[model samples]
Target: MQSPIHETTELEELEEFVINFRMRRLKLGFSQTDVGSVVGKLYGKALSQPTISRFEVLNLSYYKMCYLQTLLQKWLEETEDSLKHSSDLTGFYPFTTYQPIERGRLSQRSFTRAFMHNPKPTSEEFGYLAERLGMEKKVVRIWFYNR
Candidate 1:
């Protein structure tokens, strides 16, 4: 549970909290995008679905995880309270009306080959791969980033 940059009880607790958080979120019938829509309103900083997903999986930096935990902790409390007080929780939460972004499927074969050849592809290399894979350069970049 101890990340290299942050080896502390706090990190361990956060790691545990993240696992529980995801469970509770699913139990509450909330998707990552659903949480993302309202988490910002819980505090001031709005997080995207991808960001929330990263936080849940501990893919973020220790510092970023710490910050997001504070926000999500508050959100968890509010969401629970809403569930307790209302059968229709949507009335209590200000879930956004915006549509979720369409997720792009990557070409696994090409990406795997690219990764094996160069784990950290340069900007130009990323552009080339993106063109060959028919995906946005940013998507290709994020794929590598997540890896």
Candidate 2:
């Protein structure tokens, strides 16, 4: 079991941030899908609805959580600034939205083959694997990191 000290740690802070982010999102009349789309436009990477859902629930790894927190923080800052400067939210409309080319669990056969070849792939290898598997390199890297 976890201790009381653990409850007040950075993870707890992150949890609070996630809850606040959700509240702010809802107050701004945005859905998880809308956030996903906007985040893709704001940042280079596009998150899926499931990814955002998992982020809110803290189901992601600590590294991923931290990374996403940074992204979301930036997003919130920009969004708030837009709201302050503009009469409407139309200025924040995404010119291009990203949708994942592939969605679902990675194939066990391909994953096993890659794992056998190299338990820890380098950055280049991760990119290659991501392209081959139709997943983001970061997602592939996190998968290997979790393993």
Candidate 3:
């Protein structure tokens, strides 16, 4: 029950968020990978560098875009506050250089095994699978939901 005009306005806002997110991330001297890592630390789920890049390019769904915008906005505020209080920025540089673990796509067999084991995993199960698969817990949860 949404109008076309409302949808258009929402798209414009999302575009603006993406532009601002990219600019602020660059100004902070944090790469996409760094932002992803920091986000992972802040939130329990970790996003990958490619996912961060996709966000900057506005390639994700609106729901995901909004979620990431909230996360990045909080991160940006914290980073700015840290810079204001610290005499040097050296402490922040380590995050920029740190590399997150690489995770490839989950195999069909593994997906089936997980889905067959429990269609609706509890939070603890989701966390365990996410850690074992090197994927975000949300991703694991969604996969189960969709299956």
Best by lDDT: 2
- Can you write out model 1's per-residue Cα lDDT over 1-147, one digit (the tens) per residue? 657666776778999999999999888777787687577665767688899999989999989998888888888998788778886665675343322232223367677888999999999999888766535689989989998
Runs with alpha carbons beyond 4 Å of true place in candidate 1: 1-6, 94-147
What's the TM for model 2? 0.59
Q: Give all TM-scores, in the order shown.
A: 0.58, 0.59, 0.58
Instruction: Give per-model CA RMSD.
Output: 12.6, 12.3, 11.1
lDDT of 2 at 18: 99
The weakest ten consecutive residues by lDDT in model 3 span 95-104
Using TM-score as the measure, name the better of candidate 2 and candidate 3: 2
Ranking by TM-score: 2, 1, 3
Q: How many clashing pairs per prediction, in order? A: 0, 0, 0
Query: What is the alpha-carbon RMSD of candidate 2 to the true structure?
Result: 12.3
The residue-by-residue lDDT of candidate 3 on 37-86, one tens digit each, is 77887677778999999999888888998898888888888778878988
What lDDT does each candidate get?
Answer: 0.77, 0.78, 0.75
Q: Evaluate model 3: give its lDDT.
A: 0.75
lDDT of 1 at 140: 88
lDDT of 1 at 31: 70
